[model samples]
Target: MAYRHPDRETIKRILEETDTIAVVGLSDKPDRTSHMVSAAMQAKGYRIVPVNPNADTILGEKCYKSLKDIPFPVDLVNVFRRSEYCADVAREAAEIGAKTLWLQLGIVSEEAAEIAEAAGMNVIMDRCIKVEDSILLPEGKTNR
Candidate 1:
């Protein structure tokens, strides 16, 4: 079955409600898209947890090797990995009881969406989180 993303209002609500975002594949390199996006989100007051096995820290946040390795709760799992790897991510997100599974711009996987949705996780595919936040909440969401 084809996967459909949530509506604009729901997306806005997700942003408004989300506090901590676990960024999968977040790179330590400043030039990387993942790092840029995560940094933007962090600047917007969202807690960004860098999930990368290769990095000890990024943007001053300790990096976790995997979702399960995160000791705290994750509001959303923002994935920067390739589409082929997202299903595994979705499963890990579910395992960690993440509320949402978001695949970044230009990446989509129906399998990943299915797994996450079945686990009661809100699934957003092929969308940039920072772009959506800037568009939907121009004033920015209050983490308070």
Candidate 2:
């Protein structure tokens, strides 16, 4: 009954192929980790959509209160909420048909991961997206 993520190769494939990401709990504050990570992804040419109930816009992109409010399909849902809230995000990710559900560093929920995996969505837990992206790049290709 435990959830197991796919191998590194599969995760790499998912990350490399994803072009758009919906950043749940993204914040407008410049000092916030969510903002920093979103900025990094945006610089890498990935379309970043900020999903936060209080944010109107972050990094020049329009913000949405929830995943369901996003008009277009997103390849990944990068969650920044606490572990206790991840299951809800995972459910919403599945409901909105996101291809992947990623729990940001320090946030992990086995139940959420299982739910996402069961929905055929790729799952990455307790990992920083920026860090993973950097590690996935070859020696000479890394910018960070």
Candidate 3:
């Protein structure tokens, strides 16, 4: 079978420990998936850094032109781009010493996953962090 990314326990640990997330391809449009997901993460007490080549701001956070432009350490690099673009972003994420590379739902690239894993970074592909977080929340806790 293909490499099953970290087991459930490991994934939970990573999610619990990760505090800051850099959302690549983030857009200012409220209707965009990236925007909505980032907003949800922020609501859950995670610091969200917006990364977009064309945006100046998103969710009140300064929008970085690229992953390399972010001045601080990013615990997680949440990719919101097309599959073809993920490998490049994964390269940058690895170079920047990010702890994890999370490819948003529907955005999957084996090459990207391999690159990040080779760099000793955790990788999650074809999944939505927001949805995962919601699913993992306590029984009565609101995901909103």
Query: What does candidate 2's lDDT look like per residue over 30-95, in tens digits?
Result: 999999999988887788999988978899999999999999999999999999999999999999
How large is the C-alpha RMSD of every model relative to the true structure?
A: 0.8, 3.0, 3.1
Tens digits of per-residue lDDT for model 1, 1-112: 6888899999999999999999999999999999999999998889999999998999999999999999999999999999999999999999999999999999999999
TM-score of each: 0.98, 0.92, 0.92
By TM-score, the better pick of 1 and 3 is 1
Per residue, candidate 3 scores C-alpha lDDT tens digits across 1-144 of 254667677777778878889999888999988899999889888899999878888899998998899999999999989999999999999989999999988888889988998999998988889888877754323334
Question: lDDT values of the candidates?
Answer: 0.95, 0.87, 0.87
Q: What is the lDDT, from 0 to 100, of the residue 17 in candidate 3?
A: 79
Q: Report the error of model 3 at residue 98, Å.
A: 0.3
Worst 10-residue lDDT window for candidate 2 reads 135-144
lDDT winner: 1
Relative to the true structure, candidate 3 reaches a TM of 0.92
Candidate 3 pairs with clashing backbones: none
